[model samples]
Target chain A: MGDLFTDTIVISVLAATIRIATPLILAALGELIAERAGILNLGVEGTMLMAAFAAFIGAYATGSTLMALLLAVLAGMAMSFIMVFMAATLKVEQVVTGLALNLLAAGMSLYLYKAFFAVEGQAMPTVAVMPVAPIPFLSEIPYIGPILFTQKVLTYVALLMVPVVWFFLYRTKYGLEIRCLGENPKAIDTKGMSVSLRQYGAVMAGGALCGLAGAFVTIGSSARFVPDITNGRGWLALVIVIAANWRPSGILIAALVFAFLDALQLQIQGIGVQMPYQIFLALPYVLAIVLMVLKSRRGRSEEPARLGVPYFRGER
Target chain B: MGLRLEPRLAPSARWQAVSVAVALLAALAVSALLLESAGTDVGVAFAAILDGAFGGLRTTAKTLAKATPMILTGLAITVAFRAKVWNIGAEGQLFAGAMASYWLYTLTGPALGMALLPLLFAAGFVGGGLYGGLAGWLRSAFRVNEVLTTVMLNYVILYLLSFLLVGPWRDQSSFYQQSERIDRAAWLPDLWAPGKLHLGFLVAILAAVAIHVVMNRSWFGYEVKAVGLNARAARFKGINVERTAVAVMVLSGGLAGLAGMIQVFGVNHRLESDISLGFGFTGIIIAVLAMLRPGWVVFVAILFGGFENGGIKMQVATGAPSAIVSAIEAITLLFFLTAAALTRFRIVWRST
Candidate 1:
């Protein structure tokens, strides 16, 4: 009985860990694509915020999780189009443009919320949360079944996208072009391919993924929109991209590790740990910083050569 | 068979001006679509913004008041940027400065320190500079990127402040969770009777002039700008690039810190979460719009400040959410960045 109880608790925690990591994994994957394309979109935060809002609004209006997710993805792609215009077409500093987009996302979303729902202190109705479905035979198994198999459709998509992204990035021609441009835009430019077009494509891909991640927050997780709800997760996603060194597979592992840490915080709080909740709230960020420092110290830092600079074809 | 076009070294000012106009129109068009979808008139919404910002003398003064700290934060970014030292952690440093000022006032507010507002301000300046210098030292010594260090330090400082405020520093009497209010002696005097505009406005103007002189006329300023333009080239000319970087960051952090002190003394009069209101981030926008020039920062800062100040009034009156103003700000920053980029580099499309 004792062994069974301990096994159950561990499995349960791992299941919770997967649930928490899903959004981060999705968002980080998007960031990986953007960074791999040599455009560091700092506006991931804004993109996520807008996605979250769009997801909530869609879910609330249509009452269909699928529709909400779709709208959220479109909203995210739209946001990325702005980055495309700024970084790819106009050749602005991608980092600054991304940062501005984030600010714009937050401000615009909040304004829309206020303009519509400016009730003094009334709460808005929450939409239906994402439904969980368990795999037929696997879910019936004692410990391993529910932990791995039973989750929202989005979770499965997130896990599946990991290998899909890996395959696309490594085996595909378009992915090769992206990697080539990131490594040396001048070389890619010489190949008679428009470096700008490839970059715009990559950023849009990332933006769509980020939108999915944001929709997950509203429809899949909370089923309600809150102002500034994206908080700093978008930034965290950026850090995860770096910590994973722009590897899609590594992004999966990093996302799980960070999510486990986040889950641990909640478990500790649930079990009445003596420490302050604020410390736990800050633990994930602290961990990311420590991981970055450790990774940098070990000289295992793998950064693309010309990551943040705009490519002006003739300039050296 | 195709003629290749030579890339221009510099984009014409005409492109920049047009880009700015295009960006604004784009932002407005996007915002209008959002409003239309929500079933609101775009005209009424924008009019509300203009009126809230400049409808009255009281509002204009309020706008200047809002712009006050922006001048300092804008200068902080402009200085470090000119030296090519990315100091995104000004928000963290600003928090540290406010905390330091709070500490000073807490210790001296009720006692002999009643006559020491100037001393307290000095302490605030030193505190912000030191915090900024910490990131600088880490980068210069360890070759750690300032971007990462500054970003990390922001979280660390935020947590530290949270720990202090929620635990040891919590005000005992108030319903609102914040630090103990400083004695009246440490409080900044309002410049006018009705408006909340304080002595901080004058200080912002004076600092702008000081920065103008230091950036344009002074050798130190020239050295900083030279390093920004080309670090290796500046080093070739016998300039101590590292020292200049450190000095500019320290000065930059100090100015940001002073903005925090002004908030604590002038507006809030107590340390709270809303003390800086993301002024540090907004300063980046202000600096960009001003084209990183100290003189231009003044005009840009006031415009942004006016919008923010008026934004609050608009929020109160039209019930238009304050986030609308922030959206405008975000759009404005995006536009300015794009404009700057277009001015610096323009691509001519010709099929080769």
Candidate 2:
């Protein structure tokens, strides 16, 4: 009986791990695409915030999870479009552009929330969180089923994207061209293909994926929207991409590591451990710095040659 | 191509100034449109903002008071950015300074009287400097990117502050996550009776002047510039790039820390989580639009400071949320960056 109890606890923690990894996976994969295309879009945090706000608004207004998801994806894409436009067309400094987008989102989202959401003499309005979908026959298994198969639809999509993204990056022609843009954009320019166009495509696609990640933050789990609710998760995804060495499978493992830490913290807090919860909250950020230091020390890296540099057709 | 850009050998100063003016005007136009669309009267909002920002000596003093922290933070950014060392952790460093100075004040229990003021400022500078120095050390020792490390530190310190606020430092009489007020003896001397302006404004200016001297008239400033222009070239020229990076961050973080210390003693009179209203982040916009020039930072910070006060008044006069100021700040930044980029090239028409 004791063994069974321990087994159940372990399975529960692992299950929570899969569930929490959803947003990180989606956002990091999106970041990977953008980085592969030579645009270091550090605006992922802002994009996620905008998408999360949009999803909350959509879900609250229409009471449709699908509609919320669509709105979120659109919001994400719109935010990223700004990043691509400023970075590609004007060749503005990507770092400053990214910072501007994040600040814009912070102000706009709060302004909209205050202006539209709050009602007089009422508690904060909330929408119904999405119901979990347990797969037939698959969710009945003892350990693995509860841990992996019985999650929200977005979790499955996030996991499935690992392979899909891998295939797109390695076996596909467009993926090859996108990678080439980062490595040597002049090659694509010499071939008469528009470097700017390819960057636009890659970044927008990444933004759409980020939209999904953001949607999961509020519509999928929480009943109401909170300002800066994504918190540092979006930034964590950026760290995961670097720690993953810019590979789909590596991202999967790195994301799981972060998710597991979060899941374990939740469980620890649930059991009412005798420690400050703030310490648990601070772990991932602390670990992110450690991971980056370690990654920098290691050999055989896969960093893009010209990751943050803007391309010029005539430049040497 | 219908139109193309040709690089300007020397971008005309007159055109740069004109374009920047047009960009600010355009940002205002966009803000007006946004307000109109949001069911707010553009006229009332702008007028209210102007009145709140500069209508009288009191409001004008308040605006300058508001700009005090920003000037320091803006200079902090300008100093580091001039060396191309990105220190995104100024927000965190600011908090570190506040917490450290407060802790010192509590320990000393105002026994030192007004003499404690300089000690608190020193503690703040050291607190923020050490926090910033960690990221610098990481960059120099581990080749870790300062951007990520500094950002992570920002989040980490907030949690630390949160813990201290709720656990050890919690104000028992009050219900918020903040510490007890500092001794009145340590409060900044009031500059004017019209508004609650304090000595912090003068300090910010003095800092700017000191920074102007350090950055332009000193050999260390030249080393920083060389490293920013090209690290490899600087190293080849016998400059220690890594050490310079650490020194730049220390200076940047120290100034940001001073901003935090001043906010507590001069404005808030107590250290709380909300003491900093994203002043550190806004410094980036100010520094960038100022073209990383310290002289321009003060003027830009004052303009933004006016926006802050005006935003509150506008929110009261109209139903619009005061966050519009932040949005406008960002819009101005985007437009200014574009205008700066545009100034580098002249439009050329091509025959197809």
Candidate 3:
């Protein structure tokens, strides 16, 4: 009674929650933009993996966290370039193309890791993990301050992105055009706007955000890159996008929910819970399926009509 | 207007053959570049791959042994993708099969004598089929995306397997989280006594042949194709689209589960995590590169099997990472898909 649910533990768990949610929020918002633009980039996981690996390698080589972040973003964009090129230009099956990117990343990352760094089989190279940037006055506040203010810079950016993404999706003209591309690409094509061009833009931008998400997984949180470091976090973000119903605010809630489970799992394991840790490890994915079932019950979902269907001008 | 794409009424066989060849050459060229960049001699690596694949009878047997599980997973993918049902949980389904078969063997191994092996295989099939059925039901009933659900299920089953291995099934003798070595009587008989080729390879070949016939000649096959081509039209034509989708998943999952069970009974002789080294994902590449044809699946799987076996040898000799093979396989699929798109369309210069 004095240990598990104590005030100190609660605060630490909540703080961990925010830190874990950072990448999910970034990736989910990125996926949201792609879904809105009528491109279902199932390659988000692959895009994130490539970026995470790129960020890790960059950090190790250049010894600059900023350069690592930039490298990750560029890697994310490069992967999305292939995704958009295949989906928008070549019109290959979107699902297959996305899977190809995933497999490609899985193989290429492991190959490069082994060839470049792991060849020695000596000490695992470490990077300077992002220093936590606490807000000046806000960080001094009580429980709330530690939970929210004391976080990496990317964590704050992830939170701020929710509103920024909301504004861009709902308020701006280009956002309107992008949304129109998802619901009715023919409408944009008829009005003399390039549907594919906007799709490329939306997907590439979303990819950049996923890059940042990937960067956070490495340079932001951990000091060393492990094989399959992102694990299923990338997939979890896809689930969050669906649970969020493709909305930004909903995405933040859904991400925090999943991240909370992760944080709680970490805390419970730390306290030496009686149950096997694998059960806790498996909870988020189980909940993801449950959340999807709940999502399906809610009618009038905002899923884009043309999502996953490639647009060809003049085709009904 | 400069250039336009005009759909070919029916793509010529020659164009397809040429495109595939070009895709292969380009993919191998990239692999060569990767090897050279890694400080490995390109010519030696390529020669090593070919020699390791088919240098002698012993090497060829190893390649076939390596290809066995992939062939099954490849067939699993072919069955599901044929009906446009993306069941990406072959990895999880494989584990479920292994666990189920192992559980059944431990429970009834003494009572069931000769019937043990067949029953274990059946248990594996049922186990995998049911796991796949769950995803199918979720997709059909709840409108959950099969891709996402299947992917999640893969991770869930892995954790589940990890829990079982550590808790209930941990072998006391060894420190690893794995089961006791299976009974010697339960081992699959070797197809070639002198070689490493086992009866499991025969089963994979048989599965491939069965899948080819079912996909091409059966009425259920027609229903699956109809549903995949156009679900709405298939429904209008009196086909139960949802049920077909579920059935497709069951059949696909059964094949993958069988692969996992065979890996346990035939190859490793124990249940372990390393049973699947991204075989499910690699199966996707194999199925696609084969153009989703069962006959081609066997050929492509063997080719990849050679790369895997060769890459390991190259690593020993040249210190290059064995991961180059997987990278090469993925690059091939991407290039092939691009070439397929190019061949499917004929470019026309338009002047308006």
Candidate 4:
């Protein structure tokens, strides 16, 4: 057991966990906002996918990492706007609309990439990644230095988002209005606030974050986008949102834990273990299932009270 | 004041039809604009799309061939959605069916006669049904959310298929990690001359009609719909909500499984990822576009089939990605969803 603790593989696994968790942390933070607004935006997967591709394209074209990141976030925000219109204004079933948007994003992005780039492979042009902004003296520190300082800009943003989100939700009036709209639109309506606008704003915010998270895969870490590059990270983000009981700070830790499991799976597969690599491949999903089961037993207390139910003006 | 809930009166069929048509037109217009913005000629693209969808006899055959699995999967989605089951595991279920049928076909090829067809179908059905049933069971027993469970199962099944293909069930002789070829006797007969159109097309139409009868005429179908519209009210009416949910799921899964069996027997004659072609999720689009009506499912399935057929041609002609069709389908779903939501309730403005 001590050997396992001291293993180089274990150390590398911890490093990889941070890398993997970056995207999840960012995406989950976004989802946390959307769900907190009583909007179930299932299209996070698709939005991330499109953003990932767009980020790669942008980075590859301009050879500038910042531009790629900005463009990706904009694209994500645009997609979320569509969801907001459907759910907030039109009052459709959030689940169906979200799923449709995801499918649309998946199909459109893949098609567009193939049409424009004319290539299909695991990697793309290697653009300059976001520079690791290490603190002046922190770089000299031991274990925490590499983990905390020597990472992409998105990593710090994702980490910072937890507190920022917590502050935005707990310390601000707008955040309170968003929560009120989610929990009870009627109450918000009675207060003379535009519930639809607040809900839309929250969902759009989530979309922007999801896009940035996806761009992290393209511009921050990998510097490339493969087909389906988002690869269920969006879903994992959804799981993280639930695991955190929709709390922003909790989302950060849950994202890290889920990312750790995913990173652990990769490390286990790499160690040349005798077990079938298939089992390792199955690990993340297995963990998701376990988490879901545990969540189901915890009762409906944790879920947003009015999740997935559309609010109509009058006739309730 | 006390709250009182009332049933929403059904909208006129003419209005529903109009809404669907308007949604389709909106989808096309938006996609056309997108194409134009992307520097493509919209007129040429539209013409090309049409030609690709139904250009010649060959195109029609291709469209029908593609429509086969879509029809079954659409039914799968429709049945499940009608009962409010939300079984998003059709893709995985289809994979399961193909694997099961392929496993049986490879094992019982020589010994099994024409009887192999029914057995293979059964294998596919059982595989899909069991997979779907697992989600339903979890939902009914533990009150687990079916949406998340089904979605998670999809990933599990995908990994399972990939693992099996790359490992134990791999055909060692082949360059690709694929299963051995199934027996020719189990292959579905072709009804078209000099084209890929097969018995599956006719089966799809027949199945659609059969579903229409079931949904409109059968007591079970009525129960499923009632349970779907309102579970609490359905239970109050003495309906077995859990049982109906499970039964609908099983039937839905069986339909999806049959889709897989058809692909293996009718088109691919083997177990592979191409058999799915994302028809499982595409079926969801079709069901939504059709508004979960069986008769309408056929029409929507055919429309999607045409788009898919044309999409391949578009890819060849314009170098557009094949996934463009998925994008269009997704847009249609989004449009329909918004349209349906707006039409469901009137949001009239009133001066305070």
Q: Against the true structure, what is each candidate's TM-score?
A: 0.92, 0.97, 0.98, 0.93
lDDT of 3 by residue, A1-316 (tens): 6864588899999999999999999999998998899998989888999999999989999999899999999999999989988898778999999899988888898898888888584988889999999999999998899999999999999999999999999999989999998899999999888788899999999999999999999999898887778898889998999899889999999999999999999998888879999999989999999999999998789999999998876685
Candidate order (lDDT): 2, 3, 1, 4
The per-residue C-alpha lDDT of model 2 at residue B158 equals 93
lDDT tens digits by residue: candidate 2, B302-345: 99999999999999999798888998998898888888888887
Q: Where's the lowest-lDDT run of ten residues in candidate 4 chain A?
A: A116-125
Q: How well is each residue in A1-316 modelled by candidate 1, as lDDT tens digits?
A: 9998778668878888889888898899998888888887888888999999999888888998888999999999999999878887777767667767877887888888777764678887688999998988988887777887988888999999999888888899998888877789998899898898899899999999999999888788895678888767787788788778789888988999988988888888887978867787777877776666665666555677778777887777
Candidate 3 per-residue lDDT, tens place, B192-233, comes to: 866578888999999999999999999999998898889899
Q: What is the TM-score of chain B in candidate 1?
A: 0.93
Give the range of the ten consecutive residues with the poorest summed lDDT in model 1 chain B: B1-10
Over 4 Å off in model 3, which ranges?
Answer: A1-5, B1-6, B110-113, B348-352
Fnat for candidate 3 (0 to 1): 0.82
- Candidate 2: tens digits of C-alpha lDDT, residues A1-316: 9999889889999999999999999999999999999999989999999999999999999999999999999999999999998898778888889888888888888877877776446799999888889999999998988999999999999999999999999999999999999899999999999999999999999999999999999988799888888898889999999999999999999999999999999999999989999999999999999999999998888888988899877899
Backbone clashes in each candidate structure, one number apiece?
1, 0, 0, 0
Q: What is every candidate's C-alpha DockQ against the true complex, given to 2 decimals?
A: 0.54, 0.79, 0.87, 0.66
Q: What lDDT score is found at residue A167 in candidate 2?
A: 98
The digit string of per-residue lDDT tens for model 1 on B238-323 reads 99877787788789888988899999888888899788888888887788778789889989888888778666765665555666
